[model samples]
Target: MKKKVAKFSVLPVVGASIFFYSFSTNKAQDINTALLEEFKTVNEELTFEVPYSPDAAVFDPQLRSYPALGKSYVAFKEALGFKESGGDYKVINEFGYMGKYQFGRGTLKLIGIRDTNLFLNSPDLQEAAFYANASRNKWILRKDIERFEDQVVNGIKITESGILAAAHLAGPGNVKKFLRSNGTNSFSDGFGTSIKHYFKKFEGFDTSFVVPDRKAKANSPSVI
Candidate 1:
C-alpha cells in the first residue's frame, strides 16, 4: 500500500491571491476617484449657474423715471395735470370737476376764481388753480404734514407731497381722517381714485416750496 501527497506551491497561490486583492482594491480606489472627479465637475458647473425669473422682462425707463419736478413749477404742475386730466385744459368730468387740475366749482371759488369757463379753457389758470389749492391744503394740513412726513404708515412713507396729493384726491378732511386712521380709512373720489394710491404715486417729490397760506388765491403772485 502506497500513500501519495499532493505537491502544489502555496507561495504561488498566496502570492497570486494577494496580487489580485491589491489590484482589485487599487482598481476600486481609481474608480471612486474618477466618480468623485465627475461629481466635482458637475458641482462646479452648477456653482456658476444663476437662478432666472419667470418674468424677466426689462423695465421701461420712461415708466420708471420720475418726472423732472426739480426743473420748473410749470413742469411739475403739468406733470400732475397730465395725471389728473391728461393735461386737457377743457376737460370737465361727470363729477363737474373742471379743467386739467380737476377742480370743482366750490374749490375754484374758494381760490377766488369767479369765471368757470376761464378756469377750464386757460391752462395757465388751471395751473394757477392747482397752486392755490395746494397752498390751501398745505396750510390746512401743516401740522399733520410736519408730524407725518418721512414716517411710514401702513407700509408707505408719508411725504408732504404725498399728503397734499392725497388731499387733492379726497380733500383735506378725508386726508386727515385717513392719516389719523393710519390708512385704514381709505377714501376714494367720485372717479374711484384712492387716497393711498395718490400718496404712493406722489411720494418723494419736492413740495417744500408750497407755503402754507390761509388766503391762498389763484392770482397770488407767490403761488408757485
Candidate 2:
C-alpha cells in the first residue's frame, strides 16, 4: 500500500510582539506539520496549546480518519443540510445553531448573544460556545462522580462506556435507566460508543468545543 502525505506551507506574521500564522496547502502531512508548527509557535507566544501530543488510543484510523468528534459534527452537518444552505459557515440555523457544534438559539440567548447572525459569523461566539459545551461536560462528569462513584471506580463495569457516553450525550439520569433496562453494558453498545468516538476529534482541534446541552435537564428529550 502506498502511504499518502501532504505538503504544508506556513507564513508567520508578527505584530505587537505576537505571532499570527496562516497555514495553507494542508493535506495529511502538511496539516500535521502545520499543527506541530502552530503548537510550537503558540507555545513560544502563549505558553501552551494542548500540552500533550495525540496518542495511539486517540489517533487510530477509525477515529482520526473518520469523524473524530463523534456524531455531533455529523448531526450538525445533517442540520445544515436540512436548512438547505449548502453548509455555509456564515449561516446560522433557525434554532440559532452554528459552527461545527450546532449550538441552539436558547444557548446563545443564555450567554447574552442576541443577534443570531452575528453569533454565527463571529469566531468569538464559536469559541465561546465550544468552551461552554466542555464546561457542561465537566459539570456532568462531576455529577456522575457524585452519584455513581462506585460504577466509575470499578473500571466502568456496572456503568459501561455506553451508559457513560449516553449520559454524556443525552443525560446521566436517562443513561442510568437505559443501562438497567438493557441486558448490555459496554461503552460500544449504546450512545456511549458515539460519544467516546467523537471526544477524540473534539480534543484534536482547539476551535472545537463540546459544550453540554444545558437544555439537557432532568426530563429533557435526547434527540439533539
Candidate 3:
C-alpha cells in the first residue's frame, strides 16, 4: 500500500509539471508571434520612400509660380494685382470694387465698362479696363508726375509709377491734393489702404507702356 500511494503521488506531480511546461511553451510562442507582428509593422512603415534632398527643400505644387518679370510693365501690373486681389480676376471687395484692380462702378463706367457682370466675368475686359483707367489717371496727373518725380515727400522718393499707383488708390484729384500738400492731405480707401502706402509700394516700375489719354476707353481699339 505505501508503495502504491507513493507512485500515485509521483504520477500527479509529473502530470502537473508537464501541464505547466505546456502552458509556458504556448505563452512563449504567443509572445514571439506578437513581437514578429510588431517588427513587421515597423518594417513596412520604413519601406515607404521619404521625400529627401541634400538641401532638405520641400516644393509645393499648389503655389503660384513667380517668373522673372523684373521691373517691367508686366511686373508692375502683376505686383499691383497681387496686392489688390491676390491676382484673382473674379474677386470683388466689400466696398463695391470689382475685378483684379478693384475698380468701383463709377470708375468702370468712366472707363466704358457698362456691364458690371460682364466686367467681373471677363478677364480680358478687366485687363483692358485697368489699362484705360491707368491711362486716364496718367493723363490727369501728368503735371503732378512731372512736378513730383524724383522729389522726396514725407521721406518717400516720388516716381511716375508711384504717382500713377497713388492716383489709382485715391483718384487723380485726391492724389493731386496729397502730392501738393507734401503727403499731409492723406487719403485712405474704405479698407484704410492709403495713397502713400501705394506710392511707396508701387514706386520705380516701368509704366511707359501706358499712354496717357484723357478720354481713354476700355473698349477703344488703342486701349484693347
Candidate 4:
C-alpha cells in the first residue's frame, strides 16, 4: 500500500506559490512525494532514446525546466484529490484533457495516444508525457545543431547536449528560427537556476501511488 501523508506542515522546497497554490494539504504532499518516486521508476522502465542516463539523469545545461508542468501537477493533485476516498485520479480540465500530464484531446490526437481510459487512469500516461516531450526535443535539437554548426564555423564554443536540453523545453523550431534571425545568447537572469532546481526536483521523483482499481475507468462527469 502507498503511504499517505496528509496535511502539509511545510511548504515544499520544490516550487513557488504559483506552482503549488491550487493543491490542498493532502494533495500537495502526495504530488511532491509521488513526483520523486515516478522519476525513479520510469527511468528504470523506459528506454531513453539518446544520451541521457537512467542512472544519472541530468538536465542538459541549455534548456529551461517545465515550470508550467510543476504547477499543473499541483493543480491536478488538488482537483483529483486522490486521498479523498470518493475522488478519482484523473485530472480533467474544462477543455477535456485528462491525467496528470493533462492530455488535451487535441494533444492526444496529435501524439496518437489512444485508449482514453488507460491514458487517464494508468501510471502509463506519465511515461507517455515524458516520451512526448522527448519527441519534441528531437525535432528541436536538429535545428539547434544546424545553428550551432554555424557558430562553430565562427570559432564559438558549442555542445550538443546543451542544445538538446534547450530544444526540449523551448520548442526547437522556435529557438532555431530565433537564432537564425537573432544570434547566439544565453538564458537571462534566474531562468537557468529555476530550471536546474526543477530539473533536479523532477529527476528525483518516485511514483508509487496506490492507483485504485476502480478509478482506472473512463472519466465520469464527477470525481467519484
| Candidate maximizing lDDT | 3
Q: What is the C-alpha lDDT of each candidate?
A: 0.82, 0.43, 0.88, 0.44
Q: Distance from true position, residue 163, model 3, in Å?
A: 0.8
lDDT of the structure predicted as candidate 1: 0.82
Look at candidate 1 and give me any clashing residue pairs: none
On TM-score, the candidate that comes out on top is 3
Compose the digit string of candidate 2's lDDT tens values, residues 75-113.
433332333335455665564446544556565454445
List model 1 lDDT by residue over 62-129, tens digit each: 77665555634455566678888997889888988888888888887888887886666677777778
Cα distance off (Å), candidate 3, residue 160: 0.6
Better of 2 and 4 by TM-score: 2
* TM-score-superior candidate, 3 or 4: 3
Candidate 3 CA-lDDT value: 0.88
Output the better candidate (2/3) by lDDT. Answer: 3
RMSD of each: 15.5, 32.2, 8.8, 37.2
**TM-score between candidate 3 and the true structure:** 0.70
State the TM-score for model 2.
0.33
Error in Å for residue 117 of model 4: 3.7
Q: What is the lDDT of residue 25 in candidate 3?
A: 100
| lDDT (Cα, 0-100) at 203 in candidate 1 | 81
Per-model TM-score on C-alpha atoms: 0.65, 0.33, 0.70, 0.31
Q: Which ten contiguous residues of candidate 4 have the minimum total lDDT?
A: 206-215
- In the range 1-224, model 3's lDDT, one tens digit per residue, is 99999989899899999999999999999999999999999999889777885885578788878779898888998899889899888888888788898889899878877788777888888888888899999999999988989999988899999988888888999988988998899999888898889989999999999999999899733222
